[model samples]
Target: MVGLTLLALFIRLNAQDGILLYPDSYQFLLVIRGLAESIPLDAAMGAGGDAWSAPFYRLGYPILAFPLHLVIADPETAAKALSLAAGTAAVPVVYVLARLALRSRVAAIGAGLVTALSFSLANWSNFVMPEATAVFLLTLSMLLAYLTGRAGRAVAVAAALTTALLVFVRFEMLLVVPSLVAFIALGAGQERSKVLPAVRLYLTSLAGLIAAFALALWWAFGGVMSGLSVDPTSLFQAHVIESTTAAHQGAPALSGLRDFLDREPLLILAGGMGLALALRRRPDQRWALWLQMLPLLLLYGLRNDMRYFALLVPALAYASGLALDEGWAALRRLATSQRAAPALAVSATASLVVLTIVFWQTDLTN
Candidate 1:
């Protein structure tokens, strides 16, 4: 935990040279500054001084940074501070999930280290975007899912609430709702008699919260569809799905895959090996991991935004840690001679370090 905290602080403090604002960061800054004004709803303005509104972006991140902005009086620093704090909080959450679900302390520590150094996630801590917060929320959900096996109604309710709040951070988080429910069901399987009761309690709480949220939006906007600016399609009154999807269409799906491979080849490769290992050794956890990864897979296949890739960092890191541990065990078995074992261990560590450097350099060069 001390190591994780130091790594998080280092990443946060060393993201950029000077100015922390990026293209997306500035967009969020506009919203945050707008919210600081007396009339927040219509005060949002872009760099061009034109009125801007982002209904799909969610107000959660802005609200969190508003107080900090007031104190610091600098939009960029305030935004970065909020993101840094959220990203830092995610370190422990990832560790706990890896420990409980993967059942390996070494894997847990590796998970924490990987998450702290994840380029996509760490870089965003310098931005005003909500990606860091999303990572934290997702990790918390994973942790809760793992704990549901031993917990009762209170934990179930807490899990439901945490998952529910994720939607306010990113609408894509809604995909996790079904995944969380299935995970809780898997946990409930331990107690045959209590399975239905557990699932019912979880599902009921999640649904009720979502229903209330929808109703509030409906009343505020005259209709839920109105809040999203619905557009009619040529066919049978079908509404066009509008959000950030258009911005994601510029890049090809294969391009995103290539970028991920370049940025974190070892992590991605080890994660795949770990996935297979988990499937064989721990089928229950393997399924939960897959559930969490579904959104990232879909995004890669469809939208292909690198920023969206932060969603998979925690899961990939956890899987990579497991794979690394397995590789060490396999190498030890392969080296039958005591002298050969020591030599192989040194070689393996050196090779991983070299590979990490090469991948990071290649990713940056690309």
Candidate 2:
């Protein structure tokens, strides 16, 4: 875990120097600077002028990066550092998530390695945007939510808090709430006697925390939604309906998903197989995991931005790990049963060659 995290950090650090800064990156930098300099939220929101709405509404990333900004004295560098740190931290979190979901150390380590080396995720981590931070928090929230069944009430509360923080980082992540509820409820159902109590406690705590957080945001910023956009219909139209319409006109609805798959074809293919296997082998967790991934999948199906798919990396890494483990086991069995050592060696070499070509053809940073 430590080695994988360091590898991820090193890669991100190297990737940071040459990365292009987008409009959103500057918005995040403005938010970080505002927070570090003790500027009021409203003033900070207006700091970017009328061109870009202040990203101050997504307070979680700025709050985390502000201290680093004060110390580093460079908002962009500080934001990048925070992103790199969160991305690196997610490697081990991915490992733990994979372990919990797959029950195999080999699979967990594979997941960790995949996360450490994931090109799309690494690219996002080098930016001054909130994607990396959101991904980290989302993965952590998933882990905590998954543990609620075995770890009990405190973990459930922690999951809710983490989810609240996640929403603060990326309002789109609010979609995760229903998925989390499904995860907790399905997990609790395993404890037949305690199912209702567990579900009630988890749901009640999540609601209370969300309500308190929303009120606090409203009190502090005069609004709970992102920026000055308080109208739910406007927010929905801007983020969802407009994107969907544009996606349909510009390209296929699944273009974003297709582009994501193009970048990591091997992992996606393996992960799909692994998920199918898991559905059969881990009946208890199948729906929970499916629900966790469904919302994002549906959203991306209607959008053409591949960057948003970074949120799915942790889950895909875990499934890829499972597939890799199963493949290795099958190979060993084949080699042993058929006494085809030479054939097995050639096949392994050919497989590696194909993977090398695929990776070599794909860009690790965009």
Candidate 3:
């Protein structure tokens, strides 16, 4: 299923209809090209501008594309090729994360199936965006972090570094780190003495991430997110500029989000309910989910909706798996104990397919 998804999305990516998702799509690609050319990473060269402040988003993708850019003068195609690969990898990463979370092979495959066919997700591959790569990197990092927490001390150090790298890929991933912290703390038997040390370690890892981001941004662009001179205290105003500018560069954020939900209400609702159910299973998980959703909510509530929510499709997919799991359990209990096997399986498969179709079809391909 993961292979099929990779082929499906890669074919679509290769056959893109020349639909540039946003005006700024070229900025990142161009910046990578310029970086390859050894150009200064300043707005003069496209780094410190509103068009692109952080050119190293998912640097793993661009690094893979470095050879491509060297060979192909048209950096857009090279950069997008990298995006496509990362997007393809995201399918398996989603499966891995879902499997880790749910501890079910069938559920994991089912979740990846949903993620792979999500048109919204596949679309990211066709563009010069970091969401696909970010999701893949962050999800993989999340999985490793959780597993490390389960394993104990030696793995925890590596987990810290990997989790930090994940943050460097996408800033929003900071929200989910709590799950790793919890896993680690819990692994330490949650003894009172262990909790404080775990907290200190997590904070230290987070600080390392922030420092890494700052150093990378400074070295690559000579500024922080373009070195915009916004006051730290004026976070609201600064965000207003960023949000408004981002909308102007593409569609109004909220408007597009509203359209997405309107078109795929059932799927979105199912995903949300699944997330709620998963969170309800544990208090710490609830806090982690809350942290994950809170920033998106705050940002979208204040401005246009982000078109890149599909990039987080794996997160959505895991939640959807939970929803499907619950519904399947309920239906099985409702039907005759041993007679409705075929019907139950058919019903479950149908719901999952419908969700995949909804996600694929409703993508804002423009």
In order, the Cα lDDT scores of the candidates are: 0.66, 0.71, 0.60
Q: Per-residue lDDT for 285-346 in model 2, tens only? A: 56656775787787666567777788887667767778767776777777877666875887
TM-score per candidate: 0.80, 0.84, 0.76
Worst lDDT window (10 residues) for model 2? 43-52
Candidate 3, pairs of clashing residues: 43-48, 119-360, 253-304, 253-305, 254-304, 254-305
Q: How many backbone overlaps does candidate 2 show?
A: 0
Instruction: Determine the C-alpha RMSD for candidate 2 after optimal superposition of all C-alphas.
Output: 3.7
Model 1 pairs in collision:
none
Number of clashing pairs per prediction, in order: 0, 0, 6
State candidate 1's TM-score.
0.80
Per-residue lDDT of model 3, residues 1-366, tens digit only: 557466557555554776665555656775667567865444434424443244443344554565788987788877777777777777777677657666666657666766666655566667777666676666566566555555544465566666666665555566667655655554444444655555566567668766775566457644423533323244334434554444544556466577556554544766787778866754444543455555655555434444546544655676676676676666767676675787777787977977676555645453
Poorly placed runs, candidate 3 (over 4 Å):
1-15, 44-73, 179-202, 216-240, 244-246, 249-253, 263-267, 279-285, 331-366
- By TM-score, the best candidate is 2
* Model 1 C-alpha lDDT per residue in residues 198-238, reported as the tens digit of each score: 66887788778766765664454333223233221221121
